[model samples]
Target chain A: AQSVTQLDSHVSVSEGTPVLLRCNYSSSYSPSLFWYVQHPNKGLQLLLKYTSAATLVKGINGFEAEFKKSETSFHLTKPSAHMSDAAEYFCVVSESGKLVFGAGTILRVKS
Target chain B: EPEVTQTPSHQVTQMGQEVILRCVPISNHLYFYWYRQILGQKVEFLVSFYNNEISEKSEIFDDQFSVERPDGSNFTLKIRSTKLEDSAMYFCASSFGQETQYFGPGTRLLVL
Candidate 1:
């Protein structure tokens, strides 16, 4: 069985500050990890993906996530937060053609 | 950059009525998928389609649910009997390969 756990249910950050959303996964084999963002009433948008090639993956909107095999973690981060960055983030893991998503973390950017 | 598209941004229906959610995948994509998210919940996979046939489906996909790619471009998910529990945001996604999938705007279904 493959699973993903997003640590924080909600994260608040002021504008121009750093942001972090934590995630951990359990997989028997190498898994494909992805970060997706969903704005209110909008579909999910892929931010970035990590196969086996790169441990550090860069995504859109100044977002990035690091895949740490030792800790089984893939945490999303941004150097600075913007109001537009407020959204629900999901950590997903894919194995054997199926995807398992985390509970999701709601990011709130305060101006 | 072609993207997937879905229709009926929102739908309100009575229980027991049938509803069909439509999606148009990116041209030249071979794989298609459907997922749903209940309010404040994780996104759950329903089914995956390839070669005009169902390649895989999750436990959430029951006999009451059926998927079809009736035309060359349109893919549809049909719910035989709508239930109150069926109210959620349904997303349609397509991928050229088995890698990253592009999603549509999604259709919000409200079964009353």
Candidate 2:
């Protein structure tokens, strides 16, 4: 069984400030992790994924995440937050072709 | 870039009525999926389809739910009977294989 947990239910940041969304996972084997974003009234958009390829994964909109195996963490980060970055973020794990999702973190970017 | 598309962005129905949600996946994609999110809940997988048959399904996809690939471009999820608990945002997704999936805008179903 594979599961993912998003540490924060909500995160607030001012424009140009750094952003971080924390996530941790529990899996018996090597896992495939992903970050997805959903703006209001929109569908989920894939941000990035880690499939044992690179420890550091870069995503669209100047966002990135690092997959730390020992810590069982895959935290998403952005150097500077923009007002457009306000949305909900989900940490997901793929197990046997099914995607198990986290509870999601609501990001609020203040301008 | 190609993307998945869904129909009936919103719907309202009475309990025990049947509802069908439709999707058109990206061209050349082979795998399709259905998922739902209740109010203030995480997205939950319902079923996965491939080659005109079901590849996998979750417990939530019980006898009331059925999936069909009626044509090369369309996938449909039918609920035999609806309940208030079934009200949620239903999403359709497709992928080239078992890799990353692209999602549709989703249909908001409200069962009253």
Candidate 3:
């Protein structure tokens, strides 16, 4: 079994400020972790993924996430937030070819 | 970049009516999937398809739900009878294998 938990239901950040969204996972096998962002009325866009590759993965739109095995965590981060960054973020894990998505974290960026 | 495409961006239906959602997965991709998210809920997997047959399905994929790759390029999900609880955003996705899956914009189904 594999599952992901997003720590925050909602997070607010001012434009140009740093952003962080936390996530943790539980998996029986080596996990494939992913971060996806969904803008309003839009489909999910893949942010980044960890498939036993680089521990620190970089994604589109200046976002990145670090996969920590000891902590059982894969937290998404951005050096600075933009108004366009407002969206819902999901942390997902793969199990037996099925994706298990976490309760999403909504990111609200204010100017 | 190749992407998954779905039809009927929004559909409203009456209870007990049948609704079919359609999708076209990325070309050359071998795996296809359907997922749904109720308002404010996590995205839940409904089913996965490969080789013209269902490879995996979730508990939510009951007898009322069926998937078909009727043609070489298109996949469809048919609900035998729509329920109020069935109102949700349904998404279609495709992947090369067990790798990252690309999602479609989704069909917002509203059952009254």
What DockQ, on C-alphas, does every prediction get? 0.82, 0.84, 0.90
lDDT of 2 by residue, B1-112 (tens): 8889999999999999999999999999999999999999999999999888999999999999999998889999999999999999999999987979889999999999
Which pairs clash inside model 3?
none
Candidate 1, residue A104: Cα displacement in angstroms equals: 0.6
Model 1 lDDT per residue over B1-112, tens place:
7889999899999999999999999999999999998987888999999998999999989999999998999999999999999999999999889988889999999999
What is the per-residue lDDT of model 3 for residues A21-89, given as tens digits with 9 covering 90 to 100? 999999876799999999999998999999998999999999999999999999999999999999999
The CAPRI category of model 3 is high
Model 3 regions lying over 4 Å from their true place: none
Q: How does candidate 2 score on lDDT?
A: 0.96
Q: How much lDDT does each candidate structure score? A: 0.94, 0.96, 0.96
Report the C-alpha lDDT of model 2 over A28-92, residue by residue, as the tens digit: 99999999999999999999999999999999999999999999999999999999999999999
**In model 1, where do residues sit more than 4 Å from their true spots?**
none
Pull out the clashing pairs in model 2.
Answer: none
**Residues B1-112, candidate 3, lDDT per residue (tens digit)?**
8889999999999999999999999999999999999998999999999999999999999999999999889999999999999999999999998889999999999999
lDDT for B55 in candidate 2 is 95
